[model samples]
Target: MGRPRVRFTGRTEADAEAVLAAAAAHDACLSGAPADWEIPAGCAA
Candidate 1:
C-alpha cells in the first residue's frame, strides 16, 4: 500500500503548526517510528 496523502485547506499558519505539534506529541506518546511530518522546503508558512 502507498502512504496516505492529506491536504489541509482554509487554515492559517498557526493552525498548520498546531496540527504538526499534535502529530509530534502523538508520536511521542506512542514511542513508535516517527513519520515524515514537516513543511516542504521553500514553501512559505
Candidate 2:
C-alpha cells in the first residue's frame, strides 16, 4: 500500500486552494498516525 494521490486542477486561485485544502483534509482524516499535511514544496495553488 502507498499514500493516496490526489490530482487537482483549477483555473482560479480560489478554486485551486479549495481543492488543495480538501485533499489535505482528506489525507489528514485518513492517516492513522499524526501526519504533516503541509502542501508539498513547489506545489502551485
Candidate 3:
C-alpha cells in the first residue's frame, strides 16, 4: 500500500507560504539540522 498523503489548503498564497515555512522549520529541528541552514528558494515562497 502506498503511504498516506496529507494536503494543506490555505485561504491565500501568503497563508500557504507560512504553513510551508513552519513545516520546513519543524522538520529541520527534528532532524538536528544546522542552525545556519538556509531555506530553499521554493520553500521561501
Task: Give me the candidate number with maximum lDDT.
Answer: 2
lDDT digits (tens) for residues 9-36 of candidate 1: 5666757666676555445443332354
Give one digit per residue, the lDDT tens place, for model 2 in 1-45.
666665655445746665666666657765522244555433445
Worst 10 residues of 1 by lDDT: 36-45
- Please give each candidate's TM-score: 0.36, 0.37, 0.36
Prediction 2 global C-alpha lDDT: 0.54
- List model 3 lDDT by residue over 1-45, tens digit each: 432232344346756665577556656554434344455444443
TM-score of candidate 2 against the unseen true structure: 0.37
User: Distance from true position, residue 39, model 2, in Å?
Assistant: 16
Give each model's whole-structure lDDT. Answer: 0.48, 0.54, 0.49
Which ten residues in a row are the worst by lDDT in model 2?
Answer: 32-41
Backbone clash pairs for candidate 3 read none
After TM-score superposition, the amount by which residue 26's alpha carbon in candidate 2 deviates from its true location, in angstroms, is 2.4
Name every residue pair that clashes in candidate 1.
none
Structural RMSD, model 2: 8.3
Ranking by TM-score: 2, 3, 1
Which segments of model 3 are wrong by more than 4 Å? 1-14, 31-45
